[model samples]
Structure formats: structure tokens, C-alpha cells
Target: MRTAILVDGGFYRRRAQSRLGEKTAEERADELNKYCRRHLYHHGKQVANLYRIFYYDCLPMDKKVYHPLLQRQIDFSQSDLRTWMYAFIEQLKKKRKFAIRLGKLADEQAQFLLREDITRKLCRSALQVTDLKEQDFLLDVSQKGVDMKIGLDIASLAYKQQVDQIVLISGDSDFVPAAKLARREGIDFILDPLYNPIKPDLFEHIDGLRTCDPHFNPNWSEKESTE
Candidate 1:
């Protein structure tokens, strides 16, 4: 069977950081490639040949934004995040059978908001306005064209019958319409949420739900230990 792997890059990065620990850009790219390959196997045996791995993400914001807490203009073009993101994308480009689909950040909508914990503390009067720190705020940037690109690709793949199966690594329900279309085209649709809990309604839309993260699957680790 031929298989295409689609990844929600933002979701994957967040999960990987929380579960797999922090790593450099190059190391994270390598880890992502390996993780996608694990889905090509079933019950310890190869079941499909990889068609390609499509990674979807928005390029980091590179515009200057006014910081509310710091009361200064922050130039994201010189930020470490922008540098690391470019390096990560370059590494993915060098990987065989990898395709990168880049979306863009909505520059006008970009702003900093207090973190959830910080917000709660302020509301309860546990913290004063002066207690706010730069680190307590997060940049809230909206992504554009990512979901559209993913949906378009899924429709194209299904219509062309390019692959027998398509595995999507995302937890968002926005792909439900595309998933339904793929199913009608007789393509096996698999979801890998990386152990994130999804709504029950999502179960009916997928042919299978699977995650290849060894860190979450104890059986996989046990088998590896014995091998």
C-alpha cells in the first residue's frame, strides 16, 4: 500500500516538546522524520511504502510588534524563534521524501497576551499589575492558509487516488470535511493525535486512530528493550 503522511507542524512541535523533551532544531527535524516512518508499519511489520511526508506550518512572525508589558517595539525579524524556525525548515528540506507547506502569520492580528496562569492570578488579586513580567506573556499570532492548504491537499490526493492511505497527525476537528471526502474515495484515513484526547465525534470520521510515539506506548518500548 502507498501512504502519505500529513503533519500539523504546530501541534506536533508542542506535543513533542512536552512529551519528548526539548531538542535543537536539527534534532527535532530528525525526530519528526523517524516518528512519521513508524506509521508505515503495523504489528512490527512494514505495511506500506511512503509516498511523501507533508508538513504544514506557518513561518514565524518577522514584523515589529508593540509589547504591552515591556512597552517597547519588538522586532521579531531578529528574534531567536525566527532564526530557529528557518534552520528547522532548511533541515526538513534536506530530508528525503519530505515536503514543506508554509503558511503565513497574520501580522496585523499579532499581539501579546498574558498567560493563562498569569491572567487568573491577576483576576483573583493574587498578583498586582506591577508583578507582571515579560516572560508571563505570550505572543498570540493567528495562522493563515494552513487549514486551506491541508484541506486542498487532501482533496487533491483523494481525487487523484495518489495513495491508498493518508495519515494525518492533527487533533483539530477542522479536517473533518476533508476526512469525509477521502473516506468516500476509498482511502483509509488514520489520525495520530500523539496521545492527545480528541472528541468522541471524531472517531467515526477516521478508519483508524493510531499514534507512533514510543514515549506514550509502553508496549513498544518493552519490545525495543528486549530486542
Candidate 2:
């Protein structure tokens, strides 16, 4: 069997950071490659040949944006996030059988909003508007063409019969239609949410649910330790 692994980059990064802790760009890239390869095997046996790993993400916003809290123009182009993201992408490009698909940030829709916890506090009357600090806000931006590209790739892979199995590393229900299409094409659709809890409705759309997180999979951790 041939398997193609598709990753939602933003989702993966967030989950990885939360579960595995932060790492340098190079380390993160290596971890991502290792995680994806683990899906090629099951129960200590290789079940499928890797076709390619597809990573979809948007470039960080590079334009200057006025910060309402800081009362200054922030140049995102020089931000550490931009630097780290570029390095990460370059590292991924160097990995064998990796395809990087980049979407773009919606510049016009970019704005800052109160963080979730802060918003909740304000709503509950525990915090006042004057209590808001610069760190209490986060920049919100929309990613354009990411979901569309993922859907298109799924369709293309299914139509071309390029792989017998399609493993999506995402928790988003937005791919339900794409998953349904792949299944109709006789492809096994697997979902690896990295141990994240997904909606129960998502289970019916996938052929299998699995994750290769070392923290959760003892077999994986044992294999790694031996290696």
C-alpha cells in the first residue's frame, strides 16, 4: 500500500508546541518528519510505502500593523516568528519526500483581538477594559487558500489513484467533504489528530483514527529509544 500524509501546518505546530514543548526550527522540522514516518508502519511492521508528506501553511504576515495597545507600528517582517517560519520551511524542503504548499495571509483582514482568557474575564466582569494589557491581545489573521488547496490535493490524489491510503494530520471538520470523496474512490482515509480530542461526528468520516505521539504510543517511544 502507498500512503500520502497531509499536514495542517498551523494545527500541527500548535499541538506540537503544547504537547512536545518548543524546539528550534531544525529540531521541529526533524520531529515533524519523524512523526509522519511513524504512520507508515503499524504494530512494528511497515504497512505502506510513503508517497510524500504534504505540509500546508501560510507565510507570516510581513507588513506593518498599528497596535492599539502598544500605540506603535509593529513591523512583522522583522519579527522572530517570520524568521523562525522561514527557517522551518527551508528545513522541511531539505527533507526527502516532503512537499511544502504555502498559502497567504489575508492582509486586509488582519487585526488584533483580546486573547480568549482575557475576553472571558471581561465578559464575566472579573476584568475591566482598562485592565487590558498589550500581552492580553493577539493578532488574528485569516489564511487564504489553505483549505482549498488541501481539498484540491485530496481530489487529485484520489482521482489519480496515487495512493491507497490518505492520512490527514488535522482535527478540522472542514475536510469532511474531501474525506468522503477519497473514501468513495476506494482509498483508506486515516486521521491523526496527535491525540487531540476531535468531534464525535468526525469518526464516521474516517476509516481509522490513529496518532504516533510518543507520549501516547508506548510502541513508538520504545522504538525510538532503541533507535
TM-scores, all models, native as reference: 0.93, 0.92
The C-alpha lDDT values of all candidates are: 0.93, 0.92
Q: What does candidate 2's lDDT look like per residue over 1-227, in tens digits?
A: 99999999999998888777789999999999998999998888998999999999998988998888888988999999999999999999999999999999998888888899998999999999898899998898989999999999999999999999999999788999999999999999999988777899888999999987666432346567787
lDDT (tens digit, per residue) of candidate 1 on 124-215: 99999998889999999988999999999999999999999999999799999999999999999999998888999899999999997667
Off by over 4 Å in 1: 216-227
Candidate 2 global TM-score: 0.92
Q: How accurate is candidate 2 locally (lDDT)?
A: 0.92
What is the Cα-based TM-score of model 1?
0.93
True-vs-predicted CA distance for residue 121, candidate 1, Å: 2.2
Which residue pairs clash in candidate 1? none
